[model samples]
Target chain A: MENKILEIVNTVLENRGKKAIRKINPSMSLRNDLDMDSLDLAELTVRIEAEFDIDIFEDGIVNTVGEIYAKLNIK
Target chain B: MNVLITGVSKGLGLKLTEVLLNNGCTVYGISRSLSPELERLITEFGSNLKWLRYDLSDTNNLKTEVFKHWIGLGTPIHAFVNNAALAYDDVITNMNLDALENMYAVNVFSPLMMTKLVIRQMLLHKIKGSIVHISSISVHTGYKGLSMYASTKGALEAFSKNTAREWGALGIRSNCVVAGFMETEMSSTLSEDQKNRIYQRTSLKQQVDVESVANTISFLLSDESRSITGQNIHVDCGTI
Candidate 1:
């Protein structure tokens, strides 16, 4: 589960083609902490939804991948 | 009508599919080469709609998107609409080869392949169908850095008109609806100046009305528009 959050942050950070996820914590906000934007958020939502078969809203706010995994109760 | 549309992956295409199905229509669409979005819609709307996963611009996948199924049904297709497009900005000299190539792939080749496949289906069914190619006003007005983007629509308009003329005897009418700027995902990058210019030129001085375009497409697809062909009908509130 922890690894999943790390992977999410890593994928977002890699959007800029650099390792922005070098250091992250559970309390991180994808936008505020890593400089991710709405499209990044949307794409991440789709990825998680597809991977876990869950539903996500376009306006749904998620601050961490742990929250995403918890919503789906995935291990 | 058994209408087939492309770019139903999201935005207008997705919405269009939803509207058509809600009104009791069987439709087909393509996106992402293939994804669960189609299945989600199918679960809601029933299996009357089948989606093909193929990119319009990739010539290799043309047959897949166009002819994936329907052969088994053996019914003449009712309508075929090309609703997907790709666009980005680059000043002529500084443009990257990759970006330009991608635009042509989505904007030009994909629609042509889609049309070719749909026409074949129409021929097999011996049914007269109308095709609506979603075009852009960019084909007429010049933007500072949109030469590549505009040219693709221009090519599509030309193709749509000629194909309509050539197939007149075949009873397949081809028409283009030149869309103005809409609140689509694609226009999220526009600046006020760009949006302003588009609205300012219009007699109504407003953004493109999506409902009106939808109505126009439906009309063309219906038998009411049997006489219209080889035309680029502007839906831009008179941006022309």
Candidate 2:
């Protein structure tokens, strides 16, 4: 599951021509590493929710891959 | 003849700026950055165009920024084009909430807020002005992933008509231009075949370019279109 999370983040990063999500830490901010602003995060969350069929936008969680994984019990 | 166009740095906004300047209208091209292409036009237009570096998505202070820009112009604006927008394609059942929020903010709220501020400026200066909200065909046609994008534009057009009604007495004319899918950098993401399919749906079966749309907008601002207001003129190749 954690690997899946990494793959999703990497897909977005790849599409955006950014570095791979190399260092994964629970505390890592999506903006800092991903160079993603609010729009990217929003689209990422949308895609993640669709893929997993979960409701994350409700709580405003799933901000980062770590948060998403934690919420989805990926770790 | 100061004209404000949000997202004036690139794509249709850049083209509109050039077209307006060619018509001898001073344009205040508002965008986050001045593209080299815009710089070239500015150099040639020489005082007919000025670029404003401000992000419309920064909703917290968009109205203030717009007011500041109007003040800086030293002349009342003759027209405004709310041309900036953002799009993300996803199913409605699982649209990105954050993206949707920011999308509506930039596409709908920012333009609405800017219009209010511009009306205030016009009222203060006791000047007559025309405003055009550049809407999209997405407002009427349903697209698989364009729900959020289309909704915001629909909202803008709705608000524009109401504004035109409300401001008509104040010498402020507001109208929306429902533009068909144009051959723009924004559409460059699509394959040629994909673009061809989209163009086939238009009545003319051709993609409208920025110049065609800009000409209509320039007409709306000029006295030639003075009697028109609260109209969503379809520059959409006769598409419904």
Candidate 3:
């Protein structure tokens, strides 16, 4: 599951011409560590919803990688 | 300001393109074809006007194509105008399924899909964007053989009102500009008697100016209408 999340995140970043993250740390903040802007985060949200068929935002803003996993687990 | 407007090849769309360019806006237009007037505007405005010619009925691939094109611009879209519409004038009984499906695809679904993308772009850039949906006074008043067309505009007005509610916290605004009968190709089908009858019902007793509608659109797109949203502003010369 972590690997899938990492792959999706990296692909979306690369598609946007942003640098891909080397690793997905649970504590890693998306804005700070991944250098993802709000648009990037929004795209990530969309990708996540499509892949998992779950809305991450239904809970709230997922600021950290761990929060994304947590929401996935909850779903 | 950067604006993305659909249906820029003729009539109200062309007038809108001209008005936006005259106001020094970098306009990105989408339509089925670039008309001669649009070509003239491109020549006059230089790089201020950019356009993509694609049929709005091709809704499935529009998001990816439009977003990719928007990224190439290297700027955030400040305003988005969903002005393209399909005029399917028919009574409930005479409406064909295939034709109605195609009409809904262009009129309702495409604009909703386009709005989703534009809102994403606005959210990503932290831009408090303005969205204006061109509706019609027919939505507010009754007319023969206009039920189908009026329904689509009604859907748009409802969508605009709710969208304003959904995105208000983000400072993004949405509104509908309801226009009256105009002297556009869309209205050219109306006979002289039909046109006169409609015009006579209006307080102004004249066809609504396409340029005036275009100018109102420009105003809604600007910060001047910053406090305005979730409302339908009528430009129908008091027809409704």
Worst 10 residues of 2 chain B by lDDT: B66-75
lDDT, model 1, position A32 = 74
Residue pairs that clash (backbone atoms under 3 angstroms), model 1: B33-B53, B56-B110, B57-B105
lDDT of 3 at B167: 83
Say which docking band candidate 3 falls in: incorrect
Candidate 1 vs candidate 2: the lDDT winner is 2
Q: Across residues B9-75, which tens digit of lDDT does each residue of candidate 2 receive?
A: 8888888888888888888888888789988998898877877788888877864455653444245
Off by over 4 Å in 3: A1-75, B70-74
Highest DockQ against the true fold, candidate = 3
Model 3 lDDT at residue B161: 97
Model 1 ranges off by over 4 Å:
A1-75, B33-41, B64-66, B69-75
Task: Compose the digit string of candidate 3's lDDT tens values, residues B1-240.
Answer: 899999999999999999999899999999998788889998999889888888999999886577664434246889999999889887888989898889899999999998997887675456899999999999999999999989999999999999999888778999999999999999988999999999999999999999999999999999999999999999999984
Q: List RMSD in Å for every model shown.
A: 19.9, 18.5, 6.8
Interface RMSD of each: 15.2, 18.1, 5.8
List the TM-score for candidate 2's chain B: 0.94
Identify the superior model by lDDT, candidate 1 or candidate 3.
3
All candidates: TM-score of chain A:
0.65, 0.75, 0.90
For candidate 1, the chain B TM-score comes to 0.90
**Deviation in angstroms for B207 in model 3?**
0.5
lDDT of model 3, residue B94: 95
- In the range B121-228, model 1's lDDT, one tens digit per residue, is 665455688999988887887767778888988998999989898777658899998888887777878888888977898889998867778778877888889999
Give the winner by TM-score. Answer: 3
